[model samples]
Target: MEISDLERIARDIRRRDIQAVYEAGAGHVGGEMSVIDLLAALYFHVLRIWPDQPKHPDRDRFVLSKGHTACALYVVLAERGFIPEDEISTFLQPYSRLNGHPNCNKVPGVETNTGPLGHGLPVAVGMAKAAKLSSANYHTYVITGDGEMQEGSNWEAIMAAAQFKLDNLTLIIDHNRFQQGASLSETNDVAPFRPKLEAFGWEVTEINGNAMAEIVPALEHRGGRPHCIVAHTNKGHGISFMQDRVDWHHKVPSKEQYELALAELSEAL
Candidate 1:
């Protein structure tokens, strides 16, 4: 898809994310907004898989480590035909498969069940290792919140990915600079991610995560080592009021707020 087309899809996803969260009365709206563009670029442009054959052995894999933002992912998956688009309205309802976190077993496009921070990269590493061991010729991509980088497990996986030389693995950090409670600077301050990741022996590319032009190339870039893209993104990208506001982390918008957010997202389309 062209960058403009991907941006349009991202706007649609953002609108759906707002609607789903407003209806569900809860969701990680801020982070969801931050990562939608990246998701759109991947699902619409870079990812290699048939929605009908999600388990195709040659298919590329995507693991959303910041799974609290699953509503955004659900919108992307539905848009990509991995699941029925109407199913998105059932998000977080009773017995709904679209829970607050993604469950790979139930969701066709989801490659792993992820909600806990720091889990997706390790699983992505495993996926890459599997492909390497079996010579499957498929790539694996995983995205995590920048705040989630504080988790010890991510560092462990970082070491392992480099140690094992899994060039097929790609890690995209949604560096929106905020966690649930505080800014990343106040919480743990893991900025300057490029140097840290490069020191760990991975090639690093930093980009505006919300830009389709930047996201697609960073995802498609090939190197001799595991690749890490430090996507410097805004917490709430498209909407004016929500952008970089910490309170919107999981706050359900009021009816008026919802209307304004919807308009903002739709205008971008």
Candidate 2:
């Protein structure tokens, strides 16, 4: 797909995300909005996988570390045919497999269940290393929130990934600078991640995480060290008023706010 189409798809995903949140009465909307472009660019363009063959042995892997934004991942997966697009409406509903966090057993495209913030990278590392052990050539990708970097488990996995020379692994951090209750500065700021990651022996690429042109190249980079993309993005990227606001972390919008958000995202399409 063209970059222009990816941008349009990201906007559509945002529309779907807003509607799902409004209907379900709750979600991590702020983080979902920030990461939709990265998700769209991955499922639509970068990742080498077939929707019909969800468990294909040789296919690339993606673990959404920040699984609270599963709504956005669901929208992108639906758009890419991993699931029915209409199924997105069932988000957060009782008996729906589409919950706040993704489930690998129930969701076709999800590689693992992740919500605790630090688990996805370790799972992705195992996947990448397994490919090596089997002499299979496939990449492994994982996306984590910047705040989640405070977890010691992630650092442990980072050290292991570097020690094993798993260049096929790519770690994309959604550096939106806001977490659940407050700004990263107020909570725990792990900013200037590029140097920190590089010091740990990974090649770092920084980009405007919301920009399609910069995203593809960063994901496609083939370096000898385990890779990291410090994606600088806004909290609620596409919607005007919600951008960078910490209060939108899990806050539901008013009916008026929802309509305005819909209108704003619709214009992007």
Candidate 3:
């Protein structure tokens, strides 16, 4: 698809995510907004997925390690035709499949259930390694928040991916600066991600995560070793007032705030 179309779809996803958070009265909206562009690029432009055959054995795998932002993933999945788009309204409702986190069984496009920090990368590594063992060509991709990188498990998985030489695996870090409570620098700074990833024997690319021009090329890159994309993005990207604000990490938008955000996103379309 064209980059312009991808950008429009991303803005639409952001608008839907904002609406869901406003209606549900709870969500990690800041992270959702930050990561939606990457998700949009992946699902719409890069992933080799079958919306009608979510369990196809040879299909590429994608795992959202920073699963708190599953609302954004759900919106993208629905837009990609993996599920009914109207189901987004059931977000966070009682007995609703559209819960705060993505569930693989209940959600057609989700690969595995992920909510706990640091688990998705390990699982993705395994998935890639499994393909290698099975002599399959499917690639595996995983996205992790920079904050979540502080977890020791991710490092272990990183080391394993390199040692296994799983070139089919790709990891994208949503380097949005702020986490749930404070800036990543104020907590456990994982900045300067490129050198670290390269030192671990994986190729690394840095890009403006919210920019479609840079995002599509980076995500499409392939190399002989595991790849890492350090995607620098703002915490609340699409909405003007919320951008870079740490408090919006999981804060529910007031009615006025929601209207303003919706207007801003719609106008961008």
Candidate 4:
């Protein structure tokens, strides 16, 4: 898909994300907005997925480690035809597959159930290892929040990925600066991510996470070792007032705020 097309899809995803959160009365809309562009680039430009054959052996894999942002993933999956787009309205409702966090078993496009911090990388490493063991050509990708990287488990997986030389694995850190409570620098700074990842023997690429042109190449880049893409992004990318505000982490928009957000998103389309 063209970059313009992906941009349009991202805007649509943002609109759905806002609507879902507004209807569900709660969601991580801030982070969802930050990561939608990256998700759009992957699903539309990089991932070799079959909507009807989600379990196809040769398909690439993706794990959303920062699972609080699952609303964004659900929107992307629905737009990609992995699920009915209308089901987005059911987010967080009782028995709805489109819950606050992703459930791989229930969601057709989700590869692993993730909500807690630091889980996606480990699972993605295992998937890459399995592919290596079987000599499969599929690639594995995982996205985690900048704050999520503070978890010790991610380091363990980083060590293991290098030890196993899993070149097919790619880890993208959604470095949106702000965490739920405060800015990453104010809490536990995980900046200078490239050096740390490089020290662990992974090739690191830093890019503007919300830019489709930059995102596509990073996702598709190949190397002799595990790759890490530190995607610098904004918490609320497309909408005004919400962008970079820590308070919006999980705040449901008021009626007036919702209308403004919807207008902003629709304008991008």
Candidate 5:
């Protein structure tokens, strides 16, 4: 798809994500906004999978490691035909399969359940290693929050991926700079991610996570080593007042705020 089309789809995903959070009265909206473009680029343009056959052996694997942003992933899955778009409205409702975090068994496209911090990368490493062992051509991708990087498990997974020489693995850190309670700088400063990753034997690329032009090419690039994309993005990216505000991390938008945010996203669409 054209970059323009991908941008439009990303905007639409943002719009739906905001609405879902507003309706659900609960969600990690800031992280959701920050990460939507990456999800759009992956599901719409980069991933090779069948919505009808979600478990197809040769399909590319994607794991949303920062699963608090599942609302955005849900919208992308709906847009990409993996699930019913109407099902999005049921988000956060009692008994709804679309919970705050993704569940691989319940969701068609999700490769594994993820919500607890620092788990996705290890699972993705396993998948990539398995593909290598089986001589499968499929590649594996996982996205992690910058705050989530503070967990020691991610570092361990980085070591394992490098040791295994899992060249087919791609890890994207949603470097939005904010976590649940405070900014990443205030909490665990994992900035200067490139050198740390390179030292671990991985190739690193940095890009504006919100820009479709940058996102597509970075995701498409192949290499001999495991790749890490440090995607610098803004928390609550599209909406004006919410942008970069840590409180918006999971706060439900007020009626007026919702209208204004919807207007901004609509204009982008």
Candidate 6:
């Protein structure tokens, strides 16, 4: 897909994200909106995968570490034909497979179930190592919330990845600077991510996480060791009222708020 097409798809994804959250009455709206562009670039242009063959062994792996934003992933997966787009309406409903977080067993495109803050990186590291050990030609990518990096497990995986020199692994940190209840500074600042990853023997790239151009290149870059992309992003990226606001982290927008947000996103298309 062309960059222009990806940009339009991202806007559509943002619109879907808002609608899904509004209808479900719950979701990680802020983070979901913040990461849709990155998701679009991956699903549409970067990752090598077939929606019809979700289990293809050679397909690249992607684990959304900040899986509370599963709503956004669902929208992207739906748009990319992994699942029916209409199924999105059932999100968060009782007994619905589209729960608040993704479930790989039930969701077509999800590589693994993820919700716990620090789980995805270790799993992705293992996946990368497995590919290296087995000589499988596949890449492993994981995206984690910046706040979640405070978990010690990620650093352990970091060490193991660097030691193993898993060049096929790509870790993208959605550095939106806000967590559930407050900004990272108010909670625990994990800034200066690039230096830390580089010090751990990984090549690092920092980019405007919301820009389609920046996102695609950052995700596609490869090196001789594990790679990390520090994606600086706003909390609620597409909406005028929500950007950088901590309150939108998990709070449902009011009807008026939703209308305004939808308009702001749709206008971009």
Which has the better lDDT: candidate 3, or candidate 4? 3
lDDT of each: 0.93, 0.93, 0.94, 0.93, 0.95, 0.92
Write one digit per residue (lDDT tens) for candidate 2, span 148-237.
Answer: 988889999999999999999999999999998888888877788988888889999999999999999899899899999999999999
Better candidate by lDDT, 2 or 6: 2
Per-prediction tally of clashes = 0, 0, 0, 0, 0, 0
Give lDDT tens digits, candidate 3, residues 203-230: 9999999999999999999989999999
Which of 3 and 5 is ahead in lDDT?
Answer: 5
Model 5 TM-score on a 0 to 1 scale: 0.99
Which TM-score value belongs to model 4?
0.98
The parts of candidate 4 lying over 4 Å away from their true place are: none
Off by over 4 Å in 3: none
Q: What does candidate 6's lDDT look like per residue over 193-239, in tens digits? A: 98888889999999999998889888889789899999999889979
Model 1 ranges with Cα > 4 A deviation: none
Per-residue alpha-carbon lDDT of candidate 4 for residues 1-269, written as tens digits (9 for 90 to 100): 89999898888889888998998999999999999999999998899999999999999999999999999999899989999988888899998988888998999989999998999999999999999999999999999999999999999999999999999999999999999889999999978899999999999999999999999989989999999999999998888999999998999999999999999888777
Q: Which of candidates 3 and 6 reaches a greater lDDT?
A: 3
Models 1 onward score TM values of: 0.99, 0.98, 0.99, 0.98, 0.99, 0.98
Clashing pairs in 4: none
Which stretch of 10 consecutive residues in model 1 shows the poorest summed lDDT?
260-269
Range of the 10 consecutive residues with the lowest summed lDDT in candidate 5: 260-269
- In candidate 2, stretches whose alpha carbon ends up further than 4 angstroms from where it belongs are none
Q: Over 4 Å off in model 6, which ranges?
A: none
